[model samples]
Target: MTTQFPTPANELDRILTLSDFNVDYSNFDDQFKDLAKLAASVAGTEISLVGLIDSYTQWIISGHGMEIQQTPREETVCQYTIMEEDHLEIENLSMDSRFQEKPFVTKDPNLRYYYGIPLKSEGHNIGTLCLLDRSAKKLAPEKTELLKIIAEEIVNRLKTYKTIELLRHKVTEVTDTKNKVVHDIRGPLGGIIGLAQIISEQGKDNNMDEVLEFINLIHKSGNSILELADEILSAEKKTTVKVKGDELNLRVFREKLEKLYVPQAKIKGIKFTVSISPETETVPFPKNKLLQITGNLISNAIKFTPQGGNVQVNLVLTARENPNVLRISVTDSGSGLTQSQIDNIIEGTSTSTEGTDGEAGYGFGLALVKHLIDGLRGSFNITSDQAGATFEVILPQ
Candidate 1:
């Protein structure tokens, strides 16, 4: 049977999202290889494959008992699997009109049984976790459920992989930004240095007017340095700020924050905790901005705190005022902030400071948080002593 190759209605979107993985068409990752092996074991099949199908190719990312890396989309049974919302199992691929004439079935491999669970991401079926066998057979109900669970695991891994890729890209951006800022600062700095050197040499001449002119130039150069720093930092800010908001479940939000920071803290030998009041359920807020705010606070807490220290995130619903308020706090068991740092934070000009472990700081934490809080018509507070510190945010609902 010669049938037209089936394509999803969201083919363009599906392909675009799939490209985010940047996966090598033939690279068989071991994590996915294990998943394929398990899938095959559960289904009692000779061949199990984890394949991602794109416009014209089915990239066999991982497979058990199969060496073929990829195949033409039209020649692959998985082409039809991605179209369905759930698992697609064909007891006999040779008997199924949709796949009978496919090259893999009619010629090489001569596969007779097929079962595929769609690998879904962002509402699109990007690939499949499939099992194939030479002899016709049916998969048991329990085995099919197990395959579905494995498929979900594959999707979760994909999400985590994509997130890691994004973080790597952001790190690159930050490194480049810092490099550019350092290079650009040299121009004004050189001017100031040259002017000061000239003044020292001319001091013996009692040339008061020339000295004053040099002083003015030096002052202007100093201002230029500050302005340049602000310009570059503001440019970085553009990537983080959001203009829109979403109705987000607070429970999910808290869990996500904990998941993100807990691992980071653990890497530094710090204990991280997130606590939300039981009454808090949902909030109307820009999710990304909230993430940015909390992320910066938690990151600073972890960075400043020494090894074996503690960091915490707290979310509370406050009902004492006319409009209900959402209170979020991040506390760290670390050396308290210096008076100079506190003043800079209050003046919205806080600069980076090294952590206890000598980790280089990312400039502008509390200042940015203050700006975001002001935008939200909220309040930001900080309290610190000889022992530790706590940063609080109060948003009225």
Candidate 2:
């Protein structure tokens, strides 16, 4: 590569990492295309590009009169341009020691004149907004300042894009959590009501043992429903329903979830399974929040899932990152959600939809669950396809 110039050892790696968070100008809107065109015209050059220099290649995100999308990092003037503290304006590439023999200057368009300004974001130079031409040229001192301003504008947009993405992720987490929590209450409440009626009507004829059994069932159902409520409510609102104090363990947590949803799944004719990793250590989590998240997830998975379909709960320790990760995932075989449904839910514009068994929901359970998770300093993710949906919660411990 013609005795590679004085490039920083780790600079390209850093640029590649930063590139992931920003927009690719290739698919960028017309405004950016217009910027590239303006840069070319103002510089009196034949070509211009908003280029992102990655670890291996130089990617052209947007430009005017730039036919190729990318080039070898060793071949472009923008590579050195990004390293400069300010604009890098070479009046004649063939006369420059570093770029004289570079293919970009000696072949094809044989580019000679180059004017570039590093695109900085979050204090790091990620790439360059550059003007190029085949003929010898010089950017006036006035034009150099203008190019720098345009480069700064591009950095501002990149930062804005990063902000929007984070917000969108948060919205989706809350929306899905809301959907699950809202759908949970109906099953336990319905069981309690139906059991109460059975006990009332058969009091005179049923044996004492049968009567006692029905009472026990009713009591269990009542407690389960109350726990669900306590979990769904906020920490302040939680006190209004009930008080819970216990650092939760993985084994007991999985058992509680199974106890709450196994019967409900059976009633709906769905196969339910729970798997707690044997390797999981005894880690402490707020029990109330734990129950609330899992209970809501299990109930919704069962509700929307078709009869004879399957729902599985998995609790595993993910040691891939710091603080170690506790991952709780629930998978359900149900009609998948559309992009519009997801967007509406996260955007707070969605109305509740009916479940497979004609079950109606208030539609904010998933949102509350999301809030609870956030309060716990955790992250939530979901993926749904034609077959069904899987919701994953990753918490640092």
Candidate 3:
């Protein structure tokens, strides 16, 4: 019996627009091309591709060892490979019954070995990063693991590209809003200046009531300008400012955790939890800085933790310390940061890398967190291993 040609679900429509992104990395991006090269080289394969598939075509976005840019979906192995949640590898394609009849096999090149992982991002199966070999072979467990990481890196790059595109769109919107706000401000400013000038010029001989009317008009116009400025400034603040606190301590944290990240964590299958052992209830710390420090750390934790993984937020009192301190910690069961990343982040020399979910972030969040900690006269430390990572902030009471 002839098998049905497999295709991606409805999500294909949303992510298959390869041209819509218009990604340009001269020749090709170092990361994708490098990953492809590394994958093939490590696995001892001759061909590798970073690709996406539509109903009928597999578009090769990046890779090596293939002359053609695309192939018919029905004739491609990726169509079936993409169905797996993690990865799919065929030790020898000719020996596999499901793919034995495939054209890429029976036809020229007669590809014999294959390894690939599905690129799932934002709840959609976007594509695959795959290795192909003319000779039959099987990748060692370690090599297969490397392929998985490379696939994740490719997905992270895609996510970052998409995020940058979104930010570009947002910047355009902000520019338009700024222009509109400036236009609006001019009318009120002009009114205030005109009325003030009129009151000054005609004040000596004019009726007193008429002067008061001019003054009132000027006041209203001034108020209008202030309102506009405040609104613009407030909107700008929301983008970077997590929260503002006055007389804030660990008490506000559990509430903030519930209000801010709990819902987000639930959506991602991250077990977000909080623990608090307050020291004297309320300590004087810059609320904004405290929020920035902890917020960025927790955000990182959640971003790096895979679904069903754990992320913990803990606030502990260290009474034994000379100053009697409060330590806030965020830990995650995800891929940990490298030593280089840790050094760069702490020394303000480098930014962040990709998270497990492929979320794009300015490597600056941790730096900003450190800056905030310093501003608050607090100390912090970060440590990570293959299993996970942790960040801790200690503020004096």
Candidate 4:
């Protein structure tokens, strides 16, 4: 009897989530290569792999102790693993009823062991991180938990990658829009200038009828310019406000920030934590704008902070105010910035500086954050001392 394979009930949604990462299978990333190595070490296995399962194939994005790149989804043992909630551990693949007839298990290398944890994104399992060996073995419970943490890290890195790509795309869109505006305006502007010169010459020659005709031509040209401006600028404004005006949930937003920064802080040997007051569970605010504001602030703190330092973020609601206020503060145990540096950042003129570990920075984020806050009619403040620094923002709720 042929063994039946299991598929997630939300398989379509799973595939869509995978697509959002815009993963490039042709040139695989080395970041996952390191994760595969760490997985192999932690599992004490001879081979480990990070595989992504699409609709029809299993893409082995990164592998340690092996050169295999991909396999047919119908024949992959990982297809079953992706359907698992936590993990699948087979002490002997050759003895398992489901996989015993598989060619890889019965032929050639005759693999005997398989252990896999599903790679979940957006609550759907899209792939697996697995260990393969020639001998049957069991993993310790503690190690199993550690492997789970590594799986979470893989998903977090994927999310961060997607966000960076999106930001770059937005920057390109803004530049293109600016260029279009300048290019389109030049023609109408030139016509108005020419008509004005004609009107001046006619006036100097004391020809009132001709001068009035030229003036009328200039008025028509000016109206055309106004129409072009309204058409382009209005469309842009509509789209921007639509995206930026959507309401944000404080709880969900906080979770995203933790996922984005906790791993970064860990790599830098810094402690990171976020706190949201009970009263601030939900707020009618723009998530993307909040992300930009806090992302820059938190990133700045972590970059400047030395190893073993602490970075804390807090979001609280002020009930005493007539319109409740949302207060955000990012505090860090980093090298304090000078007054001149602070002034430059507020003015959006600050240059990049090397971090505690010599990491390069452009120092543009804080300036962008300042601009965003000003547009919201919010307040941004910076306080620093020899011990550490704090950046605070207050927005009306």
Candidate 5:
């Protein structure tokens, strides 16, 4: 059967002009070139092109068996092939009505067999997947399907590249905003801290009650601002370390924990205890992340436990599925958290209730701890009862 293919009127005006089609390009990546070559080999064709029709020219992003790097859109047979709803294949262009009189086929390369598939994105035709051969040949039905799949893959890659470009632009905007806020905060914070120090010194000499009160208020306000700044900085920083199941010293880790929690434990009248199994010397973790996870747990334990209540921390190396894993538990004697609180710990919202001693926080500490544990590729769980709550963190060793 023979048929004549007519160009769509709407697209005729969108076609590129000859002057705008420039092909003298030199920079092209080897990987794309190799992909085009692979496609040519699979189709048993001498020439292949991963062609993209931009606003001006039908640019060959990657190509094989072509002397010129690019060509004018008006001269690009692939441009017309993209308009076809299905693969445009011909065993002989000389006999095809669409190309028998075309200048390129009659005068230039004297092309014969040609097959082109539309490279489509989101139902819009973008370009063509084309293969060329000197002699007439017909492709199997399966090969035609495979060519369509390859064209779709190319469109997927282009979409991914555009998404990454958008994310980079967003990250740059966020960084610039954070820098400006930090700069504005530093000067006023310094003055507040300095004034508080002066008031504290004056109160110490005169023993004036009003001066002492003012100094305490100023100190508390400054500390609150500093904590806010630290949280902002910590939240902005991306995770740098990858989780690996490396051994960490549990005994030494508990010692460092004691140093961090002792003062808070004293203030709350809580007795802190750390117990580790004799054989449990090391457990798998990134040391800094372990510290962050444990620190948040211990701080929460100290905060919730009432004065004279006991908080016990335990570490054990146990066999799970015949492989060693490390388990750490923090048990506190305080008003136990409700089931809802436990469920909401990983939620981004604040779930903090006032401690027995009224410790104030935005309830972000546990949320941050959960984020760190997740980054370490470990699991954490919580249980509550009348005696209090217990938190267990387990990591593969």
Candidate 6:
């Protein structure tokens, strides 16, 4: 029996005029290859392919038992398969007018039976996972389900690739903004510092109260500008970890946090203390990330704690059947967070509240802290009671 598949002239025209879609498939690592092999194994097919369709060709990103890397779009049976909104299985393409004359059917791979599952992302159909056999055959229901599972995996991988690309663009933008800020501030800051030095020298023999005030103003302005530059620099650096479960010395980390926040705490008339169980000191973590996490917590604790209040940090290590873990907590004696604030922290939103001294924040620090913790595959939580709020981080060793 001969079947005539509907070929819409307008659709053909659009496809013909469309420019070639260029994607950097080389960036996809061994996962694609593994998926292709697994798909073929699960389907019990001789050939399996993870292919991407451009305007004029279908490029095979990864294939099992297939030497042909690409074929003309007009000749790829998978092209016809993707046109439909469902997974397709054709018992014999040679009996179908739409694919019988295609080069892939008569030439290289000598395809006969074809089953394709569309790979889609963000509502756009990008490619397909297909199994091909040299002879006409039908896939069992279980095999068909397995093929669809593999297709979903391919779609997930594409989504991940797109996410990484977006993050790279954002990182570049942040770095550019940081450089511009530094470049613009350096000139004015140097001038102020130089003029202040000159004024101090010239007023050496006079009562010089006005001169001294002017010099102090300039000095303070320079210091503020320097601090702003440092924050921008820190923000521009990529906070990614290549290795997980690397041990960090919690003892030294807590000491550094104490020293950094003590002066600020004292200024607010707040008492700061650190308490840890013996085993917590050698908690495994990516280096420097502990600093980022602890810095945000300690800074927030000091910023929000009221006068004559106290802020205490505690660390405890525990061993479980799954893995060893460390739990770090920062407790503050402040007005305490609202339920909404706790929800926002857990939900990863930009919810900011004024500090005791009306200090303002850009709502970026906690978001950055959350992002860093997620990167380390850790968990964070915020809890509050009558006394205050406690921020906790649980990290796998």
- Taking the tens digit of each residue's C-alpha lDDT, what string does model 3 give over 21-47? 433312233557788888788778899
lDDT score for residue 387 of model 5: 91
Pairs of residues clashing in candidate 5: none
Writing each residue's lDDT as its tens digit, candidate 6 over 1-397 gives: 2223322233322322211121343334365889998988988889988887643246677888785555534456776766767788999988988788877788867889899987765444567899998899988998888788788888777666556646655665675676887978878888887877777777667678887887878888887887787777665443321222222456655665665556657767899998877754544443335655665687778768888999998877675536767778999998888898888877777545556775443344566567667866999989898799999998875
TM-score of each: 0.50, 0.49, 0.45, 0.50, 0.44, 0.48
Q: List the residue pairs that clash in candidate 6.
A: 246-285
Model 5 weakest 10-residue run by lDDT:
16-25
Candidate 2 wrongly placed segments (more than 4 Å): 1-4, 9-13, 16-26, 29-31, 196-397
The number of clashing residue pairs in each candidate reads 0, 10, 1, 0, 0, 1
Estimate the TM-score for candidate 5: 0.44
Ranking by TM-score: 1, 4, 2, 6, 3, 5
Best by lDDT: 4
| Candidate 1, 121-162: lDDT as tens digits | 989999999899999999989989999999999889888766
Residue 71 in model 1: lDDT: 59
**Cα lDDT tens digits for candidate 2, 177-243:** 7656655776767678667767756766766777767776786777677666666654434332332
lDDT of 5: 0.67
For model 6, the superposed segments whose C-alpha errors exceed 4 Å read 1-22, 207-397
By TM-score, is 2 or 3 better?
2
Q: lDDT per prediction?
A: 0.74, 0.69, 0.68, 0.77, 0.67, 0.69
Candidate 1 pairs with clashing backbones: none
Task: Give the C-alpha miss distance for residue 165 in model 3, angstroms.
Answer: 2.7
lDDT of 4 at 128: 92
